[model samples]
Target: MTGNARSEETLLLRSAVDRLKTALPRTWTLDLDLDPGRDGTVTAVAPDARLTIRTPSGASATFTIEVKRASRGSVRGALERLLLLSDGQPALVITDFANPALRKQCEELGIGYVDLTGWVFIRNDSAGIFVRTQGPARQAPLPDGRTTATKRLDGPGASKVVRALWDVTSTTGVRELAQRAGVSAGTVTKVLPALAAYGAVTRLRDGGVTDVDRRLLMERWTLDYKIYRTNPEVLWRLAPRGPDLAYADLLATDLGNDPTGRTIAYTGWLAATVSLPEGNYPVVPNTLLSIYSADPGALGDDLGLRTASPQTANVVLIRPRDETLLTGVPLPVPEPQIIADLMTMGGRYDELATQLSEATSVRTETP
Candidate 1:
């Protein structure tokens, strides 16, 4: 850590300690030891300090505190190390922001984490303490003190490049990738480093993509690119026959018939069900039929779908905001996009997304 970063971290740590003290009961006490010397057993990769929390009932718990101010990858790595500490020594990561995924990881590992924004999750059954508070989701301040906004898979260009990287297994040049994704070479150029930062794709000496962790790439995309949030949508209810018949009608529509000559493809639960082997679908019935179309109005008219409110809608027509949604991607829908849609739907759809990925051969063996 640089001198400036160290100072910032120190300030954050001190503030967090104060917040912890205020959060506890009047009788409870909290103390933070900045120079908590590490024992020989604790490797050089040690925590920053120790936080001792005392309850009114005389029960106490000392937690090894590690402060992280970077990305989710850094926090995740720290949490892994903290989890290895002896059962008696619980750990907590004080970070700038802890997204839901990282918080879930901390909870699952039986560790604790408190972000700078007052999001705290410390569950120590032994100490009879369980505390969790809500925090606003804000971008962490950079070393230069600027906040990140649109970088790292945030927009349509990122979606294009990410899909391109996932689709190809062989080492690919930037220009070629851009061509494949139907994007400018600059888009691929900008997105590759972000993917590298997330450890999603590996670049070679020539700056070409050499390997990709397909699953990690998809997960990282999910953090920034949400289907409903990114696209313009209209909800509708199909006729009395419901989604199954509508899906059939979609499949029957000729690609050549589209007035704009753009692709209209089925997605979400209905798509996953169709893609999966017969009788392999989960018990969750397919209620929502999501689709991507360049023209929602035309498609709705063609399908005879009735506009409906969100609660009663069985079909959703999303006019993709990104050209890459249909450009250079597979007909019916790209596997990664479908998987992303399923994941966003969440619940049992998450499992279905996994199965769809497997069936669709989503993984390209990294070289």
Candidate 2:
């Protein structure tokens, strides 16, 4: 580490330890010792600092502490490095911030962590001391004066990457994923880390996506995405025929094969009715037929759909927020997107989400 960098890390560690001391019970005593002799070159051998804690009864324990100032996406890697650096001793990781997922990982690994946001977790069996605290659910600013923003899967680029993940089960390369998602490599680069943080996808050391948890990904996606809210749509009733006949007409239209070069597909309730087994979701009257289209005006005209009030509308011509929704995705959209759309509707559709999740969450073995 450079002299300035080491000095900054020292300051961070001291500030975090001070916060820990303040957060401790009145009866507890806390002391910090910086390992000045260790050059930090072989960080795997020596921790950045050591913490000594004592109870009123004089019971005490010492914990090796490693201070890391990392981005939110690197929290897991920081935790894992702390584990290696601490060996089998009682250890703690002090970072700029630690989200609940990373905190839970620390607890599961039986290690301790403290963050600048006042979040802390520590336990020592011999000392009979357990400490855990929660600060605000926000990231502190970096030394360079930038707030670490959490990545979200709500945007069109992220949506494309997410849908690509749903289609493949094998250990997929990032470039391959970009190609598969029909997005730029940069979009995949930004989205993968966020997806990993959400426990949706696992990445190898070389940054290849090795696994995907479709159910978890779908659940997390719904937290940020909504069918009606994320995508723009205009309500229209399909002539005088009901949604079924209209959906049938939609199938016959084969918009994917159109020479006009517009991408289109079914989604939500109407898509679920076709994808799910018969009777899994009954096609009741007035069920919304959601169609994603590149050009809603042209698609409505092509399909002979007319604008109607929400009460009378049986079909919705949706202009997707980005072409990612339609590009490279299967006709009728992917099952996960269908499930997400159902989840966005809430109410009775929540049950359909669960049913679709159970029906399609089968993983194919990676060769």
Candidate 3:
């Protein structure tokens, strides 16, 4: 292929990758590379972080990522090498404002350049600049004044809620997060304090919430989500229903089979009642059930079950044999707005899950 042809191909590939990333949101890993190539073809590699995007032509592009601290001259040199490897095909340089010098070089060369600033890309085409915004970055600032980064929160219910608030806040609250999270306004409020303490969310005085620190939330939630997602026992217990049996039964079976067994006494009953006029009664396990041979004393009081009532139907039974394992400073319960924020996150997770499933299916069906 001629130099111009290769550049055009690279440009096309760059545009395609950008579109894919926008459409798939946090489902892929992007790397930009520049190096010498074999034969006449310049290779470009685009790998989805979680899955692979296979090319129809049986050729995969080489993957490269331009580091933030790499100098403009270095990036320009790399781009030049990549263009040469492409046999003179026109290539678009996609980078952030961090590489001002390289961007300036691209402008001088009249080559196309995409600026990823403010979480949106400024595409300079023949006519003018076109703007495209992707999902917000999930990040939090470290105590050492550096930023921590991770995947966007697409986890369980509580985490999804927290991330939705972060995305809404980061994007100027144009997004309706509460409706998306599917959580009660009251519940969101209750969770906000815990999220705020971890710097996962920022609350605006006008009843708005934002994610001032997404990285922190990602790191913490990653651990928490894995525990729930990977543990068969935990997941089974949390599941709505398994094998026609109620979740309470499953929990009981699990407890019975536990290594500690009868050494750790267990006593609880599953309860069910209705909250709405038309809805059927939902089973609730009294998570506050106690187990003790002698006096359960101050330990029971410290368990923070003051809000418990017989009428509440969604309770889960829990007991702490070793209270030392539960030590932590209690976070203040969030206000109603926090619940609204979490609802937004839940919606995002649902949307992302749908998209990922579709993408996986498409990839599998493609030749």
Candidate 4:
């Protein structure tokens, strides 16, 4: 792991301990055993921290945990690494984000672990605790202090890179991968490091991408997109003078066919419910239209879009993160992006969000 990677893991360690303090049941007591001598440094290599949990009736167990920068794509290997330094004591594995699949392995093998996203599983002969809370929803790692802006991985370039890594089972160089993903080489250069910051991508000796934790990548992406990514979208509605599709087609044709405009996409009830069938979600008819556009006014003007009252709006115009969103999917925002965006809407959209999330969780690749 690189220095930044190590720092990221250490930060996650502190966060996990803090969450442990708050996540404990009122009837149970948990102590963060961060004593000076036992700061989880075992021999030359110590675990992240030592934790002790006690129930009111007096049962208690101490666990020294190993917090990885991220799960290294192998649950057994992670379990082994923790046990090696733990001297046979139970090992708890944690990552920057949780993997339910990994959590299942931990439970089956009697190992304990938690992902930053509120998924926790711990079991010992004396006590067992299982809880799932909403995970951290930050958009990206807090700026590393060296740069003014945080790394962003929500755009189309990122989608291309991430999808290639997730769907294509072969390895490719930066330039080749860029060609394959229909994105610029500069964009590939930009996205790889951002993914690496969270241990989502591993570079080859040739500085090419060799491995990617697609699930972890998406999980972290959602956390940041839901929490921090700027929504430059300016939502407005117009009572259509004609049919809703008439206006939608106008905007889609204008933006999608623009030879010299930003790459755009669409998401909202119509895109998710009608254009994309993966979500299988029921939506109100023509309730609203959302598009990924840098120049919505230009497109909206053709369709006679006007300022819609929040209560009576028939369309939503979103500012897109980047061009990568338009590459692979029929909708402006792809599945993961749409799912995360919908999650933030909170209402009937929330129901659709859940459906989209479940669908995307199983098959992230576009049909």
TM-score of every candidate relative to the true structure = 0.68, 0.70, 0.23, 0.60
lDDT of 3 by residue, 333-364 (tens): 12111222222322233233233323433543
Candidate 3 — number of clashing residue pairs? 38
Overall lDDT per candidate, in order of appearance: 0.71, 0.73, 0.35, 0.61
How far residue 52's Cα lies from its native spot in candidate 4, in Å, is 8.3
The better candidate by TM-score, 1 or 2, is 2
Which pairs clash inside model 4? 42-46, 117-135, 138-224, 139-224, 156-324, 156-325, 157-324, 233-319, 265-332, 266-332
What does candidate 2's lDDT look like per residue over 148-255, in tens digits? 534666798888888889877788988999998888999988877655655566678677887777766786677678877887665565556877787677667777
Q: Highest TM-score: which candidate?
A: 2
Top-scoring candidate (lDDT): 2
TM-score of 4: 0.60
Better of 3 and 4 by TM-score: 4
Question: Model 4: per-residue lDDT, tens digit, 33-126?
Answer: 5442444444766566677788877887888777754424444566777777677776777676554445556677677776655766677775
Check candidate 1 and list the clashing pairs: none
